[model samples]
Structure formats: C-alpha cells, structure tokens
Target chain A: MMKVLTANRLTDGIAVWLGANGRWLERIDHALIARHREAVDALEQAGQSAFHDNLIVDVAVIDVDEVDGEIYPIRLRERIRAKGPTFRTDLGKQAEFQQASAA
Target chain B: MYRYDEFDHDFVGQRVAQYRDQVERRLSGEITEDAFKPLRLMNGVYLQLHAYMLRVAIPYGTLNSTQMRRLARIARDYDKGYGHFTTRQNIQFNWPKLSDTPAILEELAEVEMHAIQTSGNCIRNVSADHFSGAAADEVADPRPYAEILRQWSSNHPEYSFLPRKFKIAVTGAERDRAAIQVHDIGLHLKRNEAGELGFAVYVGGGQGRTPMIARKIRDFLPEADLLSYTTAIMRVYNLNGRRDNKYKARIKILVHETGEAEFARQVEAEWDKLKASELKLPDADLRAIAAYFAPPELQDRAEGWAGLAARKKDDEGFASWVRQNVTPHKHPDYGVVTISLKPIGGVPGDATDVQMEAIADLAERYSHDEIRVSHEQNLVLPHVALADLEKVYHALLEQDLATANAGLITDIIACPGLDYCALANARSIPVAQEISNRFASAQRQQEIGALKIKISGCINACGHHHVGHIGLLGVEKKGAELYQITLGGSGDENTSIGQIVGRGFEPEKVTDAVETIVDTYLGLRESAEETFIDAYRRVGPEPFKEALYGKTSRAA
Candidate 1:
C-alpha cells in the first residue's frame, strides 16, 4: 500500500503533505511517497523534527493510492479533507487545484 | 444593543493582548501543545480536524448591524468566506490560523464582541430567548438580565476554574424558545401575584452523555437576589462537585447525585449567607440595564399588513415562505422574520460572506439595526414591518437564504461532526443532507408540520439531539459508521428526553430508517392537526419501532 506523511501547517492550520528535502506541499500530489520501511522511518523522523521546529502540528501517516496518476486518500475523513467540505465543491484547496488543473 | 463600557472594553483589550503573548510563546516552543491547550481553549480556540476553529460569542444571541458586518468581514478575511452559527447561538469560523487569531480577536473587540468564556470550564455565553422583547407572549425582555449575567460571569476569579463548564439560559415568554429546560441553569422570568417580576429558577438540566430535564429548585426568586443566589449555587458546586471523574464533574451530576431536595437545601443555605453581601443586585443597576432593552418604537397599522396578504395571495413561493418563516411580533404591524440557514441539501447553520453581508444590510434597513441568532441555528430579523416583508423576502431570495423551512423537517440541526470536529465519532452533516434531499418538497415538509430532526456527531449532544422530536445520534461501530434513532423528544415548555429505539443502522440505511419512522407517524396520526410528538405521545413508540425493525423486534 502507498503512504504519505501529513500535518497541519503551524502558521495557517492548513493540511500539508511532506515533500522533497524537508518541504511541506499544500497539494497532496506533490508529496514524496514513502513505501519502504526505511523510507517510512525517514519520513517519521523528519515529521518529528518538523514538530519540534514548530513548523507543523499533529503529524500522522495516511494511506493513499495513485489512481489515474492522481493521488487520493483511502479514508473518508482524509478524502473529505482533500476535497474540502462535501457540501461545498466551490471552496478549499481542492477547488483551487481543480481550477489550476483545468487552466 | 447594549454598548460596552470603558471597563468592559479595557478588559477585552487586555485579554486579547495577553492571549497574543501566549500564542507567541506557544509558537516559539517555549510551551508545549499540552501546556498551551487550555490557554487556547480559554480564548475560544479549538484544534479541529481540518484547522483551528474559533468560536466568537454573540452574547444572548443579540448583536447590531455593525457587529454583524464585522462578523462578515472576519468571515471574508480570516476564514473560508463563511461561518457556522451553533446551537448555543454562537458563531464558529472553522479555518482560522493560530497566528491570525490575535488579529481576529482584535477585530472582534472593535465591534464589542469577544470569545471570552465561550469555551472551557467557565460560564459560557448566557443565552436568552431569540424573540425576547419582540414576541407578544413575553412578560418581560430577558436580554437585559442576560447581559447582567454576562457582565457578572465574564472572568470572575473564583468561578473561572470550575469542575466543569456551566451553561445558563434565560427565557421571558410563556412559549419557551430558548430551550431553557435543558441548560445547566434555566431561568424563566415571570411576575408574581403581586405583579413583581422575579425568576423561576431551574437547576441541574443538561444533555450530553446524560440527558436530564432541569428541576425547579425555586418556585420564585426575588429579582434583587439574582446574583447572590446564582453565586450561592456556584459556590456549593465548586466546593462539593466531583473532580475525580471529568464526565461526572458537571453541576448536573452533582445535583443528580445529591438529589434535588438536598441540592436545593444546600443552595438555599449558601444563598442566606451571601444574600447580605455586596452580590445583591441593586435596583438602580437593574433599571439601567432594562433601559437598554426597551422595545423599538414600531408604527401602528392593522392586525396584519394588507400588502403582505396581497403578495401572499399572488405569489405561491412568497406565500409559503410567509407561512413558514414569518413569526408574529408584539406590535401588530411588525413580524419576526427567520432567515433559514438550513437550505435544502446544504450544510446547516452556514452563512457565506456575501450572505452575512446581505443579512446585515437587511437588519440595518428592515429591522431596527438589530439581529438575533436563534438557538435553533437560524438568523432572525426581530422586527420587520409586515408591509416590507415582500421586499425583505426578495432580498433574502437574492442571497439564497430565503428557504421557507423554519420548524419543518428540512430545518435540521446538525453539528460539524467528523468532517470538521475532532471529537466526533461519525459524520453528521452528510446524513442531514441526505434527509433534507429526501424530503426536498416544501409541500411535503409543510404536511409534516413542526417536526424537528436534530443530529449529533457524538454523545456530547452539541446538536441537542436528545431534545429533538426525532433525534439521530452518530456512533462508530467497529469500522463502520452507525446511527441510533430516538423518538418523541422535545425542547419546549414540556421538555422530554427522547427514548432510543432498538438497533442502530448503517449510514446507507439511516435515512431510510428515519423515513420509516416519519411514515409510521403519518399513517397512525389521528388528524392532520396532530403533530408528530402529539401522535407519538398518543400511541407509544411500538408502531414506529415495528416499522423500522420488523414486527417482532420487541421495542415495546
């Protein structure tokens, strides 16, 4: 199963994915996927350091799959977070990402 | 529309400044999350699932046009262009950042608003009847007394760190609109035989994991002794209330364990000692507070407006809306208009930035520059001229807020649930949306008159599910989300806790189960005039139970 590290950015409380070289990406698709045990260990270590550095809060690992070259969360909670509120399709990062993708 | 004094202003300013420094310390890692959690919660900040949610108090659910506009500005600037009004009559912005919270609090203070005592173990916002002064049935306005309570409890040193959070609700009318019976301390303003205004105090009422209707501890308490008596109760609870168990620390638990008689005796003994102290509310202060709550002068016309009746005759949509959404005012020419926040298939109690701005505009123009947030999760234009109803209706329609389902089934009350709240076991808004979609027809909703469907994401009962005529509580079973159904609950003059029916249903089957319950009520009702609660009261829950879980389910 595919996995990625996620946390809320400390400054803005927005969901961010762990990206290459200790960077946090707003878009989950840009996340640096961690598949092997060694990679997962490295990701966890980086997450702890980020927390200690006061860059993010409540870091966790989330399961995802690359379907049609698009990353999607496995759980309903994560999926809803990724897509903004289920009641609102016009708000949140998902809407912004979709607009940018279409453009 | 009570203006804040210099003392109140300075106090809020100091609080905001102090919180800013605390936030700075937390950000710099001088304090851990555990150490900073309570401090953040004291300022009404919560770490929700998606972000940091900020709940700002609209004290007693009353605010003016300027405050409402400021709220709109905050929604546009700080949050995701929207805010959710809660059942406690407060508003929550779901996407605030820790760094921007100080700025937000500073902005809120400019309009005489703050998040003080909105959360944590303190006296939360003192809620009052939404139509306190406007309603014809009211004996006196409750907002003045509520404001007095707010001033008393804002940041009292002794009661700041109670065993658990305390909630108080006040209602002045014979018709209980504030759901006072389910609060920690419920006060009903009434006049005694000698024509002296006093309060009938109810204590130990709450609806979380343990739902209990408040008991009337005092048949009549003198108006002058309000503060002393309240302090007495608080003192008793603070000293004797349980602290070993968090869930058992609420005053309701103390009252339950001690028995109502013993609790009343203890409170009375404490009150006797404190009554002679400076806590006794002075008549001059009461008069001053009451002056601010005097009813707005309304123009006298006939019993009903001719223009509105004509418009109702001409347009079906306007007619339906007027029938459902327009409530009677104390003045003959005016009406209390409730702008429905529960639009069909939309999230309950959510208003976008534009919608908030439009509502503020409406309040400024149609009403007396005053707006009210109902505990039922709707906004009210407390005093609109009946002649101007059509114009106001059109304005609301333009903003997509003119949904004509005030007390109907579609006007469902739901918490943020798992989608946003960290404490929720399952999602509630989706279930509400599904039910709203299933019963989309306005005519069908009208046929099922005054059926309240309240959904709670968890046992905390933030959605007031325990008091709903038809309640749905979301619970997690194994890995799947399940909903438990309860029937015949009400939050009125005669408040009763709903009895849970047997067997929980999967998310896919929850709406079907709700429909089955409603259908059973529809079939078994004696007349169209008989409400769901009335019908359920007449014939017990057995028929509905059999319909949901087959005839041999043994729900009886």
Candidate 2:
C-alpha cells in the first residue's frame, strides 16, 4: 500500500502532489510514494512546512497505486483533482497533460 | 442593463483591490486557510473538488452583448474555455486560479459585473424573471426592484455574517417564471384594489435539506416601502434565524419553527420601526431605476409573420424549435427565444466560449443587444423579432445549441454535483447526461410533453430537485450511490414539494426508473392536452409508484 501527500498550490489553486524530490509537482506521476510510517510522517511534516511557506493549502494523504510504473490516485476525488472536471475531458489540466504527453 | 454609476464603480474597484491584497496575504502565509476561507468566499472564490470556482453575479439575470462577450473572453483566457450558468442566474467558472481571481474581478468590473455577495452567508444575487421586461403578462418590470435590492444588499454591513445563505427572487408576472415561491424572499409585483402598483411578499421559502414553500406575509406592500420592508425582513431573519445548527439556519426554518404568523408579526414590528427610514426609495430614485428596465422600442414587424410561417412549414426542426423555445413577448412582433444550454448528453448549463460569442452576436444582431440567464439553466434572447426566428434558429443550429427542448423533458436543471462540487455525495451531471441521452429523440420528447427532471448530487438541493416534476436526488448509501425519486413537485405559481416514491434506486437503474415513471404518466394521461404535471396532479403518484417499485411497494 502506498500513500502520497497532495495539496492545492496556494498561489494558483492547482492540484499538486509531493514529488520524490520533496517539491510539489502538478502531475501525480512524479509523486513520492510513502510506503513506511516514517516516510508518511516525513511527507506530512514536509507538507506542513510547505504550508508555513504558503506553498500549498488543504494538504491531505491520498492513496495511490503504481501500475506499470505510472502513479494513479485511487480515490475518485483525488483523481478528479489530478485531472480536471470529469464532465469535460478536453478542458481541464488532464487535457493539458494529454496534449503535452502527445507533443 | 443598469449601468454602474460612479459610486457603484468605486465600490467595486475598492473591493477588488481589497480582495487582491487579501489573496496576497494568504499566499504570503500571513493568513491561514482557516482564516482566509470566509474572506475568499465573501469575494465569490471557492476551492471546489479540483480548482477554485469563481461565481460572478449576473444581477437579475440581465446582460448586454458587450458584457456577454467579455464573459466569453474571460472563459477563453482565464478559465477552461467554458462557463456554467448556475441556478441562481449567475455564471460559475469551474477553473479559476486563486492568484488570478483579483484580475478576473478587475475584468468583470470592466463589464460592470462582480462576484460580490454571490457566495458566503450574505444575501446572494438578487434574481428575477429572465423574461422580466418583455413578458406579456407582467404587471411591471421586476428587474428595477431586483436591481435596487442588489444595490442595497451588496456588502451590507449588518447582514454580512448570517447563520446561512439567503436567496431573494422577484417576479413581475403572474406566471411566476422566476420560481419566487422557493426563494428565501419571493416578491411578486401586484396592483392593489385602487390600481396602484405594489408587491405581494412571501417569506421563508427555500429548497435544501428541508424544502418549504414560502408563506405569504403581506397581501400588498406599498411600492415606496420596498427597501424598508425588505430591510425589516432581513433584520428579523438576522436576529431570529438559528445560528447553532447550519442546516436549520435558513429563514425557512425560522419561519417554520416560529410559525408564519409570529414571523410575520415580528417582521411587521420591525417594519413599523424602519418603514420611514432612509432605506425607503423616493419617487425620483424609483423612477431612475425603473427607466433602465423600460421595454425596448420594438418596430412594427408583424407584417413578416407570413414569411416566418412559410419558413416554419419548410423546416420541421425549426417549427418544433419555434413551438418549444419561442415565448410570446410583450410586443406583438417580438418573441423571447430560449437557447437551451442542455444539449443532448451535454452537461447542463455548460456553454463554450465560441458558443457564447455566437450567442452574443445573435443578441446584438436580433434581440436588442440584451441577454438573460434563466434560473432554469438556459439563456434567453428576450426580444427577438418573430420574423427573425428562422435566422436565429439556423445560427443556433450551427453552434449545436438548437436543442429545441426548452421546457420539454431534456432541459434538465442540475447542480455541479460531486464531479465539481466538494460537498456533493454523488455525481449529478453524468446521471443527467444519461437521462438526457435516454430521451434524445425530438419526437419522443415532444410526445412526453413538458417534464422537468431536476437532479441534485446532495441534500443541499442546489439543483432544485425538490420542485421538479420528476426530481432525482443522489445520496450515498454505504459505498454505492443511490438516487431518490420524487414525483409531482413544481416550482411555479402553484408550487408543491414532490413526494418521494418507494425506495432509492442504484445509479445505473435511476434513469430507467425515471423512464418507467414517464411511461406510467403517459399511459394514465386523460389526453395529449393533459401535461405531465397536470396528469400527475389529477391522478396522484400511485400509478407512478406502482410502475417504479412493484405493486406491493407502499408509496411514501
């Protein structure tokens, strides 16, 4: 079981996940997977520190699964946040990611 | 259509700057999210499931072509190339950056639009009938009073922090197209026995966890006492409305608990104290506000009706669109054309930037450069000439907006639901989409005849599911999503809360169940003239319940 720290960027209200490099990344694919209690605590502390620096808001631990070496949020809400509005696939950040990946 | 005066401009400008600074402080860690939440909400910025959603008030649902175009431009530049017109007759941008909100507000201000009082516990946007000025049956244009209320309620010092949000609606016509009966304060313009213009006031009506129809408090309130009476009502609610439990905080609960008589007494006492105050609009000021909403000078273009009839005969789609979407205007030559935002399988109320621009262009060219956002999640070109119906229909068809299902079955009113809203338990748009697709045929929809299917993702009732002819309320039972069906509810002059029928159905089975109910109604109807609502009222919900759940299932 893997968990990752996720929050909205305070400046832009964009969903960002805590990366393996300890920086907030917009794409969840780069999220740091916390497998141990110590790792989770460290990620939580890092998220708190980011809050103090006003880097992110509404930080929470989100469940994720690494399938075929690609990280995906397990919960529906987190997945929606990672992508965009579910109703319109062509409009949200998910669409931008798709466009970028295609490019 | 009301232009912002110097004072109005300065007020909005100052608020934008103040919000900009607040955002700055929040970003710089000077303010915590807990502390900044209310402040951001006060400025109509909400952190939804994904991003910050900005709801800009379309005061009384009126907009000019320039303002409409600017909204499209903002949608293209700042948002996701589209916007959702909310049920409160306001527009919501689902994806607005918190850092960019100040700039968005600044841009909105340029168009004399703002997100002030759009959210928060304060008095939200004052909405009126979309066909306010042009409605043939209207006693007076309600937008003037709605505008006056907007000016009075915007950033009011006293009602800033209420127990819960308050919604006010005004309707000038007897038809009650504004759904005034379900608002916190529903004002219906009326003429007294002496033939003097006044208002019949209804208080405490709201649709949420507990849907309650407003009780008529005043038979005829003098036009001069409009603001003073409103101020009194708000003051009474502000003081007496529950603050302990958020669910019971709405004025409807206050009116329910205290009883209508006691509430009316308290309001009257408050009115007695405040009726002669500075809140009372003078004759001169009233005239000034009313002037902005005077009907447009319509030309005598009734002569071209023969041509329009010929075109309608040639095109079956156009004829159907004309029959369903076109509304009779106050002027004989003019018609109110409703552009359905609910295209087949499309998200309700979602309009793209290009579609918006095209709509604006059509408004400018055909409908006196004015547009209206109906509370039913549709746009109205309120003054299109009857002769121009063919051209407008073709133009709308090109944009894939000519759904021709205005008040028919497919024009659904749905909240952002779980997909976009943080508070939703189940997704509403998908369900709406599924149902819309189920009833995709124009011929079938026409046969079904005027069925409103309102879907809400939660008990908040933002989708107005409480008052739909066939209301679908989504609830989370254990882990699975279940939809509760309510039958025969209406949000009209004869407003009634729909009764729940039998048990909740699984999400996949909900649309099929709705189809079953519609089929039952069709079978039981007296004639083709007997609409869904009328038939439902005449025969009650027994047969429908039997069709939904088995014959053994007891109706609630």
- Each candidate's fnat, listed in order, reads 0.58, 0.63
What's model 1's lDDT at B48? 72
User: Candidate 2, DockQ to 2 decimals?
Assistant: 0.57
Report DockQ per prediction, comma-separated. 0.52, 0.57
Task: Report the Cα RMSD per candidate.
Answer: 2.5, 2.3
Candidate that scores best on DockQ: 2
lDDT of 1 by residue, B317-428 (tens): 9999999999888887898999999999989999998899999999999999999999989999999989889999999999889999999999999999977887888889
List of chain A TM-scores, every candidate? 0.88, 0.89
Q: Evaluate model 2: give its lDDT.
A: 0.90
What is the lDDT, from 0 to 100, of the residue B50 in candidate 2? 73
- Candidate 1: list runs displaced more than 4 Å: A1-4, A29-45, A61-75, A99-103
Identify the leading candidate in terms of TM-score. Answer: 2
